[model samples]
Target: MAIALVLVLVVVGSVLFHVLSPWWWTPIASNWSYIDTTLVITFWITGFVFSAVVLFMAYCVYRFRHKEGATAHYEPESRKLESWLTAVTAIGVAAMLAPGLYVWSQFINVPKDATEVEVVAQQWQWSFRLPGKDGKLGTSNVRLVSADNPLGINPDDPNSKDDVVVEAADLHLQIGKPVKMLLRSIDVLHDFYVPEFRAKMDLVPGMVTYFWLTPTRTGTFEVLCAELCGTGHNFMRGTVLVDTEQDYATWLEKQATFAQLSTPAKVGALATPAKDVAKVE
Candidate 1:
């Protein structure tokens, strides 16, 4: 009796803490709300099953307590009860799996007009590459990286020459537009996570991963590095700004290029012709 009471108290207290706790992922503001609702349903079903089983066991102990001359009742399991329990379990499992699979399908299939953006991860910083007027991102490789080539743009490919590289800059997107994020990493694995957005994906080196989100609210959200990469992992923070179309364009224009933004220009300067130099002399 004492043990049953203690177990009941512990379970109730734990469930209450989880229900009333202030700590939780920020409210869903994107398409992930469907996922959150499904999670709630799962929790309720599981909670009910746990509570029912434990309470029934406790009741059995109290009602059928051992007496002075009472013999143990040995009865095999009933097919009817077993069948009902199995059906109930199957229904609960289906209830959880149905929504999960549906949401997963939606998450993988991005809208036709969704904008594709490439996010590259390094040891402790984040860099982004936006497709230019061509609406195509050129190929990239870490092997092409050097002191002069931070973004590893392929020199042989003219398409990459016009790619807009945003280094250490906050990412901005137009509000209400679906954005498909292609994640890559130059070093170890890292996870791109935003609590409020309720979306996250792991960035693996030499492999392209992806996630999609449509910003419903226009505000600045913190981009946290969820995976432990190194000693400086905690400081690996970034910002995402959701703004209006006009604001997004303005922000994009202000970002300088690798050549224009570098302290010392890496692109070779144009040579003065022999005649022009002689005329100056």
Candidate 2:
């Protein structure tokens, strides 16, 4: 009787604590509310199963307690019981998985008017690239990576000349504008995650992966690396600022284009050597 009472109390206490828990998810800032809905569904289904199983165990223990002169019966060949257990378990699992599958389908299909933004990840840093007046990002080549051309933008491409390159800086997005984030890793693996946004994806080397989100509010959000690449993974943080339309335009105007940044490097490369200058003199 005491054991059964304790089991019942455990279920009741757990449910009460979950309902009144002070710690909960952060307020969502993006359009992934369905993710939260799916989570709640999972919790409800699992909680129900847990409560039922534990209560059943308690009832069995109390009702079948060894009586003073009771003899143990051994008749354990009930196909009906096994079949019922199997069916219930299958139903429980399917109920949990169905919502997640539906949400995942919506996650992958981006809107037609969404703008593209490239996110470059290294072992310990985050960088971003935005389309220029041409409204397109230029092709990139790993071989072209150097001190002057860190992002490896193809200099020969006319489309690349105006691309806005923001190296290890805060990324600003205009509020309510849908953006498709293109993720790439120059070194090991990384993940771009913002808690408020509630969406994240992996950054793989030699391949580009992507996801989309629209900034529903204007504020500064901390960017964290969800993957542990190395020792510095803990410090690999960045900032994302969601701004109004005029503020976003002002920030963009202050950023230098690929051509503007590469001009000095090109000039230095084309400069005549000191020895050649003396010979010419």
Best by TM-score: 2
Q: Model 2, which residues run further than 4 Å from truth?
A: 265-281
Tens digits of per-residue lDDT for model 1, 1-281: 78678768867887898899996678665667877877788888888888888888777877788789999889788899999999999998998899889889988898989888888888898888876657767787889876666677666665565567888778888889898998989889999988878888999988899989898888898888999999999999999888999999898787664434332323322255666545544
Per-residue C-alpha lDDT of model 2 across residues 146-255, encoded as one tens digit per residue: 87788888999999999999999999999999999999998899999999998999999899999999888899999999998999999999999999999999999999
Report every candidate's CA lDDT: 0.80, 0.91
- Kindly report which residue pairs in candidate 2 clash with one another: none
Clashes of each: 0, 0
